[model samples]
Target chain A: MDQFLQLIVAGLATGAIYALAAIGFTLVWQTSQTINFAQGEFVMLPAILVLTAAHLGLPMGVAFIVGSVAFVLLFGFGFKRFLVEPMQRHGVLPLAIATMALSVLIKEAAKNGFSAEAQPFPSLVPDGSVSVLGAAVSVRDIAIFVVAIAAILGLQAFITHTRTGRTMQATAQNPTVARILGVPVERMILLTFLINAALALIASYLISPVYLAKFSNGETIGLAAFIAAIVGGFNQIRGALAGGFLIGLIDNLAAAYVSSAYRTAVPLVVLVVVILVKPEGLLGRKEERTV
Target chain B: MLFKTMAAAIALTAAMTVSAVAGTVKLIDVIELSGPGAPAGTNWKNGSDLAVAEINAKGGILGQQIELIHYDSQTNPGATRAAVQRAVDEDAYVVLGPIFSGPISASMQITQRAGVPQIVGGEAAAFTRQGNNYIFRTSLNQADSMPKLANYLRDEVKAKSVAVVWINNDFGKGGRDSMIPELQKRGIQVAADIATESGQADFAADAIKVKNANADAVFVYLNEEESARFLRAARQQGIAKPIIGETTLLGAKVIELAGEAANGVKGHVGLLVDAPKPTLVEFGKKYAAKYGFTSDHNGIKGYTAVYTVKAITERIGKLDREAFAKALHGARIDVAQEPGILIDTKWTATGDVDRESFLIEIVNGKPVVKATLPMINP
Candidate 1:
C-alpha cells in the first residue's frame, strides 16, 4: 500500500511534466486548428539557452528567464513569418511540415551551438526525501508536482477570465464570426503560439534539472504531447491535461507491475483505446449531426 | 667528354627518384573527422596523426618513408563504407577506422568482401570476430569490459543489488545483455533493467522506477549526451546511489556537463588516467605541444592502432597480404605512445588484438588508478 501511494506521487510528478507540455499542444490546437509538431523543441530550447547563458557567466535565474523570453519571442516571430503566412497561403499540412523543419533545425542548431554532451541543470527544489506511509518521496517531486498544478490553474484562469483569453475562445469557437466581430483572429493565433512557447519554456526550466536536457529532449515532449492532445480531444484544454496525467500514470504502473520493456507501448495503447471509445474525449463535446 | 658527363648525371637523378618512390609504404587512415560523430573521430585522428608523426621522425618504417592518406566518415555508416571503398580504390594496403559500432559494422561488409586488412577502434567485440579474418579491433570488446564492471560492483563497491539503464541501440543493448549473466554469476541481483532510446534526454520516469526498486547502485550504458543528462537528472531527483558507467563516460565533456554530480561516480575506462608509462608520457607531452590540448583514449587508441600497423609492417619486412596477416597475428610491439599501461600481445588467428586492461577510478573529482587487472582472455 505504501508502495502504491509512492507510485502515485511519482506518477503525478512525471504526469505534471507531461501535463505542462500537453497544455501547450492544446493551446495551439485550440486556436490554430493545427498541431505544431515542433512544440517539444520549444521546451528544450530554453534549457539549452539557459545552460549556454549560465556558462557565459550570467546568473542561473536571470539566464533561465532570458532563455524563456527568447523562446517565447522566437515562437511569436517565427509563427508570424513562416508558420502563419505559409499556412494561410498554403494549408495546415504545409505549416505542419514547416514546423517539423523548424524542429529539425532547432535540434541541429543546439547540437552545433552547445556541445553534444549532456549537462546537469542546477536543482531548484530541496534535496531531502521523506517517507510517507512506508514509501520514500523526494522534495523535488513535490516541487515539480506543485509547479505543474499551479501552471495548469493559471492557464485555466487565463483562458476563461482574461480579455485575450475570451478573444482566443471566440476565435476558436468561430473564426469567421470572431473576425466579423473584430477579434483580430490572426493576432490571436500568434498570441496563442506565444503562449504555447512560453509554457513549454517554463516546463523546460522546471524539468531540465530533474529530467535532463539533451538536444532531442524537446522531441520527446513534443511527440508525447501530440499523442496526449489526440487522446484528450484536440478541441479541449482540460482533456489534454487529463490525458497527459492518465498516460503518465499508466506508463509508470505498467513499468512497475507489468514489464518495463512495454512501458513505451502502454501509453500508446491508451491513446489507441481512447481514440476508439470516446472520440469526443472525456471533456470534449460530441459533434452534432447538423446535416 | 662534357656532353657524356651531363647525360650520366641525368640518368643518376632519375634512378634515385625511382628508388625513393619505391621505398614509401602506402597506409590509409579511414577516420571519422567531423559531423555527428566528430567527438570520437577527432580524438582518433589525433592519435593516428601522432603515431604517423613519431614513426616518420624515427626514420620511417622498413627503410621506406610511410605515406598516409585519410578520408573522413562524418560518423555516418554509408559515408564510412564509401570512405573505405575510396581508400581501397586509392590502393591503400590497410584500412584503419570506423570508430563506433554502427559505422564499423556497416563498413565491415565492404572491407571483408574486398579482402582488405582493417584495425578498428569500435568495441562491439562480436563485430570484429564475426568470421572475418580481414577485420581486427584493438579496443576491448563490450563482453570483455562488462565483467570487469560486474567485478567492480560485486567486489570493490560491494553493491548487492544493481539497476541497469541503457539506450536501446546496439552498443547499449549489447553491454546490458552481456552484463546481466556476468552480474548473476557474481551473485549480484539486478533490481531493474530499463531501456530508453539514444536520443532520449529525460529519465525522471525511469529514475523513479530505479529509486522504487531500492537499488543500491545503478549501471548506466548510454552515449555521452544521454548519459550526461541521465546523470544530472538522477542527481537532481535525489537518486543518491553510486552510478557505475560504461566507457562513453570517460570524456571530459561528461564531467563538465554533470558538474559535481559526476564527481564520485565509478566507471570503466580503457586507458588508465594516471601518469602512463614514460614513453606514453613523452608522447603526450609532444602531442600537447602540437595540438595545444591534452590527449584522451580515443586519440591514444588511434595512435596505437596506426603504430601497431607500422610495427607489424616493420617485423614483416615486406608488403604481401598473407605476410602482413601472419605478422599482425604473431607480432608484438610495446607502443610508447599510448596513455595506459599496455604490453604487446599477438593478434589471435581470429584477428583480434589480445591485450590486457587496468581499472581506473575517479576519486575526489580526479581520475586515479585504483587497481590494475591483467589481461583475462576468454
Candidate 2:
C-alpha cells in the first residue's frame, strides 16, 4: 500500500510538469493555428541557459531571470519573426516540418554551444520528504506539484477572465471575424507565443531539478506532452491539464507495477484505447480542422 | 605509352607508402570526440595523447615514429562506421576506439575486413564473441567482469537475494543479462529485475519498486549520469539496503554529481585511479596536470590501448597488422616486462582482456579501494 501510494504521488508530480508543457503547446495551437513542434525544445533552452549562467557565477535568481529573457528573445520572439512567420505562409505541413527541424537545431546547438554532459540543478525546497499518508514524498516533488497547480490556475484565469484572453479566444474561433471586430489578430498571436514561452520556461525550471539540464531531454518530455495534449483533447485548457496528469500517472504506475521495459509502451497503448473510444479526445470538442 | 604511365604511377605510390611506413607508422585513434559520448571519448583521446607523447619521448614504438591521428566518431553509429572506413582506407597500422558499445559494434567489422588490429574500450560481451580477430578490447567484457562482480556480492557482501535495476540499453542490458545468471550460480535469488530508460529523469517509481522488493542489496547497472541520478533518488527515498554497482557507478563523474548521496555506496571498479598502485597514481596525476581534470577508467583504457599497440609491435620487431592481431590473441603482458600496460594483463582467445580490478566504496566523494581481485586467468 505504501509503495502504491508512493508511485501515485510521484506520478502525479511528474504529470503536473507534463501538463504545464502541454498547456503551452495547446495555447500556441489555439492562438495562431500553429503547432510549435519544438515545444519540448522550447522548455529545454531556458533550463540549460539558466544552468549555464549559474555555472558562470551568477546568482540563481539573476540567472533564472537572465536565462528566461534571453530564451524568450531568441526562441520566442526571434523564432516567431524569422522562422515561424516566414514558414507559416507556406502551409501547416511546411510550418510543422520547420518546427521539427528547429527542434533538432536547438538540441544540437545546446550540445555544441554548451556541454553535452548532464548538469545537476539544485532543488527549490530543502532536501527532505514529508510522509503523505505513509508514503515518503520528496519536498521538491510536492513543491513542483503545488507550483504547477498555481501557475495553471493563474493561466486559466487569464485565458477565461481577462478581456484580452476572451479576445484571443475570439481570434482562435475565426481570425478574419476577430480582425473585423477590431481585434489585432497578429498582436494576439504574438502575445500567445510569449505566454506559451513563459509557461515553457516555468515547466523547464520545475523539471530540471528532477531531469537535470540535458540537451536531449526535451525529446521525451515533448513527446509525453504531445501525447497528453492529444489524450486530454487539444485546444482545451482543462483537457491538457487532465491529459498530462493521466499520462504521468499511467506511465509511472505501469513502470512500478508492470515491466519497466514497457513503461513507455503501456501509456501509448492506453492512448490508442482512448483514441478508439473517443477520436475527439476526452475533453475535446468537434471543430473544423484542416485535413 | 599507357602501360608506361601506369607503371610510373604505381612506382610513385610504392615510394610514398615506403616512406610513410619507414618514417612513421600511422595509427588512427577513431573515437567519440563530441555528442553524448564526448565525456568518455574526450577522456580516451586525452589518454592516448598522453601515451603517444610518452612513447615518442622513449624513441617511439620499435624506433619507428608513431603517427597517431585522432578521428571523431561524433557518438553516432553512422559516424563511427564512416570514421573506421576512413581509418582503414588510410592504411592504418591500428585503429583505436569509438568507446560506447553501439558505435563499436557498428564499425569494428570494417577494420576486421582490412585485417587491422582495432583496440576498443567497449565493454559489451557481444563485441568479443563476434569472431572478428582484428577486434580487441582495452577492458574486460561483460562476460569477464560480471562473474567477478557476482562473486564479490555473494562471498563478501553475502547477499542472499539481489535486486537488479538496470538501464534499458546495450551497456546496461548486457551487464544485467550477464550478471543475473552469475548471481544465480552462487545460489542467490533475484528479488526484482527492473529495467529503466537511458535518460530517465524521475526514478521515484523505480526507487519505490526497489524499496518494495526488500532485497538484500540493489545492483544498479547504468551509465555514469544515470547511476548518479539513481543514487540521489535512492538516498532521497531512504532505501537503506546496500547499493552495489560496477565501474560506471564508481566513476568520478557519478560521485561528483551524486555528492553526499554517493556516500557508503560500494562497487567493483575494473580500472580505478584511486587504486593503491604507484603506476595508476602517477598516471592519474600526469593526466590531471595535462588535461586539468582527473582521468577516469575510460582515460586509462585509452592510454593503455596505445601502449598495448606499442608492446605488440615491439614484440613482432616490425609494424605488422595481421601478426599483431595474432600475437594479441591469448597473449599475456606482465607489468614487470612492460610497465606501460600498467596492469599485468592477459587476453583470451576471443580478444577480451583480463586484469586485476578493485572493489571500492565511495567515501566523501572519492572511491576508496577496499579489495583487489586478481585476474581469473592470472
* Top TM-score model: 2
lDDT of 1 by residue, A1-291 (tens): 655666677677767878788887777766665667778888888888888888888998899777777777777667666666767567668877887888898888987888453456777776656776766676777788888889889888997999988998898788899999988988887877777777787788777775556676776677777777777767788888887787777766776676556777888887788878988876666656443
Could you give candidate 1's per-residue lDDT for residues B1-378 as a string of tens digits? 999999999864543233245677667778766543556677677778777777788887677777777788866788888899887766567788877777888888776675568888787666856787778776778887898889899988899999998877667778888999999999999998888765554555666677767888999887665667676657645687888876676554466556666767777776532434565566567667887655666676787777777777666676654456666764555545322223444466666655655566556555665656666552
TM of each candidate vs. truth: 0.82, 0.91
**Residue pairs of candidate 1 with colliding backbone atoms:** B47-B303
Question: lDDT value for candidate 1?
Answer: 0.72
Per-residue lDDT over B179-275 for candidate 2, one digit per residue giving the tens place of the 0 to 100 score: 9999999999999998987667778788888988999999998877778778887876778888998888888777766777788899888997788
Q: What is the C-alpha lDDT of each candidate?
A: 0.72, 0.85
Interface RMSD of 1: 4.1
Worst 10 residues of 1 chain B by lDDT: B337-346
Q: What is the lDDT of residue B124 in candidate 1?
A: 68
User: A1-291, model 2: which lDDT tens digit per residue?
Assistant: 988887887888889989998997788778656677899998788989998898799999999889999988887788777887898789778888898999999998998888777777766766556788977777777788899999999988987999998988888888999999999988888887788888888889888776778898898789889999989988788989999999999989988888676778887987898889987678987677556
Query: Candidate 2, residue B337: CA error in Å?
Result: 4.9
